[model samples]
Target chain A: DAGITQSPRHKVTETGTPVTLRCHQTENHRYMYWYRQDPGHGLRLIHYSYGVKDTDKGEVSDGYSVSRSKTEDFLLTLESATSSQTSVYFCAISDPAGGQETQYFGPGTRLLVL
Target chain B: EDQVTQSPEALRLQEGESSSLNCSYTVSGLRGLFWYRQDPGKGPEFLFTLYSAGEEKEKERLKATLTKKESFLHITAPKPEDSATYLCAVQATGNNRLAFGKGNQVVVIP
Candidate 1:
């Protein structure tokens, strides 16, 4: 899992409810990413943050939002959770310096929307 | 649009068997290709990164090679413990995001 950790390893929530997943990293990497893994869809990026307070949407950013208030924390929020949003969420960190382009991932958070 | 496609959704091999997994991509401009191994219920673990065509990388029993259109992850004499889903992702130039393939689920029977 590298130096990353995702809170709420498992959660079951109702549709239309709001949910937030937290990703914390001790690696102090410059890039942090949020991704969702579902069957038949490997891993789709939801959002990413290049630096503190700097964020951008990813390929599948609709219905999701992200915030990076500090160097170690990046939060993904689902304003109104939907059944389609239920999936295993993963957080990844990368430092491209020194040719280290590989991203390290956290254990992941499993979210179930009913 | 950048896309990655992995062949053979699932694979089964006996222990000590050798095999290869393929990852083909179509991106605007290639920046890097990445390989990862993921266990059940866990996040992906990084394995190797190939930056250009004809580049190769190796670990203990795994080797990754890249061409202009695709990449191959060759497992030499794999073990039962090596059974896991292998994922492939590619980064396009001028894009900070990676496009991933559905992954190849491998089961090495002992």
Candidate 2:
């Protein structure tokens, strides 16, 4: 958790506006992920980047896009924010070389779409 | 599909009380099971990682054990500060994604 930091710790944006959440890690872990936590539902993976420019969508990637231009930075962007996108976003990183890799999370970014 | 389910949506315990939370998961090949603590308004903090069945890990008043199909987080004499949401997650060998449960909210009253 200490190695990763998410910017814009809290944000309130109007619906249909574009917003971006940033996750920076000091550890330079190879695998980075973006997840959203919501009531009644478990944390859902929105997108993940295995390396810079190598990304894949998760179960809930419909409304989200991710970019990883550098090893230390991964960005999650909402081209059009909506009320349904209001949730706490978390960034996780893992080093696969460590046998059984375990993810470390950031402090999280809380977003509110009004 | 890989899935994880946690029991007891919420638990309220007095100081020094002990209890266990359950997490059941379904995956093709269970690579690793994890336990995390998330306080209100904050992201989840990693606690433990159990790699195989019958394996156990401990941290202070908390102990986590894993089995073939489930894992249990046991708290011993919990304190008020331990009040938070306990989340369970599983990483399957099938894919590189980790599946998480909704989590069990625990409140330890002083």
Task: State TM-scores per candidate.
Answer: 0.97, 0.97
Task: Sum up the clashes in candidate 1.
Answer: 0
* Model 2 pairs in collision: none
- Give one digit per residue, the lDDT tens place, for model 2 in B1-110: 89999998899999998999999999999888989999988888989999899999999999999999999999999999999999999989856789999999999999
Give model 1's DockQ, 2 decimals: 0.94
lDDT of candidate 2 over A41-68, digit per residue (tens): 9999999998999999999999899999
The most accurate candidate by lDDT is: 1
What is the fnat of model 2 with respect to the true interface contacts? 0.85
Per-candidate Cα RMSD to the true structure, in Å, reads: 1.1, 1.1
DockQ of each: 0.94, 0.89
Off by over 4 Å in 2: A98-100
Instruction: Go through the candidates in order and give the clash count of each.
Output: 0, 0
Residue-by-residue lDDT tens digits, candidate 1, A1-114: 478999999999999999999999998898999999999898999999999999998989999999999999999999999999999999999877635577899999999999
